[model samples]
Structure formats: C-alpha cells, structure tokens
Target: MKYQYEFFLPQNPKPIDTITGDIYDCEKKADEIVAELGINEDDDLIIAVTEVGNND
Candidate 1:
C-alpha cells in the first residue's frame, strides 16, 4: 500500500482547483509547504491523505 498527501484550501466541498495545487509524499513534506506558504490555522487549509496503488 501507498499513500499520497494533498493540501486543499477554504475547505473540502469545493472543486480541486481550490487545492493548494501540490501533492506530497508525507506529512513532513506537507508541513514544509505550510511553512513555505506561511499558512496559519485561519488560512482554512486542509491536509488530506489518500490511498494509492494496490497492495496486490
């Protein structure tokens, strides 16, 4: 199994364009984005994790 991380802005119900437009392999990479973009809690950004590939 594998996982991918993505960041979304303003909430999850919106279209993907609302995303931060980046994909990360791990939480640490995502955290780097938070620092780089100066994202705060008030920023309404979301870090979503999704499963990828197949275990088989």
Candidate 2:
C-alpha cells in the first residue's frame, strides 16, 4: 500500500484551492513544501494524505 501527500490552499468560506496536483512520496517532503511555500501558521493551508495505487 503506497501513500501520497497533497497540499491545498483554503478558500475563504468555500472549497480548498489546489496548490499542487503533484503527489509527494513522504510526509517530510510534504512538510518541506509548506516551508518552501512560506506558509504561515495563520495561513489557510490544508495538508492531506491519500492512498495511492489502490483500487479498493
């Protein structure tokens, strides 16, 4: 079972905006992205993890 991480920008009073459709292999890589993007603690950013290559 493989997994991937994704990041999104939160839309005010609505859906989250996709920052990158690219999937990260590890959580560290995803965290790096947040740092690289200079996302602040007060910033509306969302981090998610999903299963990859899984049909079931």
lDDT on C-alpha atoms for all candidate structures: 0.54, 0.53
Where does candidate 1 stray beyond 4 Å? 11-25, 41-43, 54-56
- What are the TM-scores, per candidate, against the unseen true structure? 0.49, 0.42
Q: Any idea what lDDT model 1 has?
A: 0.54
What is the overall TM-score of model 2 with all chains considered together? Answer: 0.42
Error of 2 at 24 (Å): 9.7
Q: What is the Å distance of residue 52 in model 2 from its true position?
A: 2.2
Candidate 2 positional error at 54, Å: 8.1
For model 1, how big is the CA root-mean-square deviation?
5.4
Give the alpha carbon lDDT tens digit for every residue of 1-56 in model 2.
55555556676443232332234344455466567877763464666666556534
Question: What local lDDT does model 2 show for residue 25?
Answer: 42
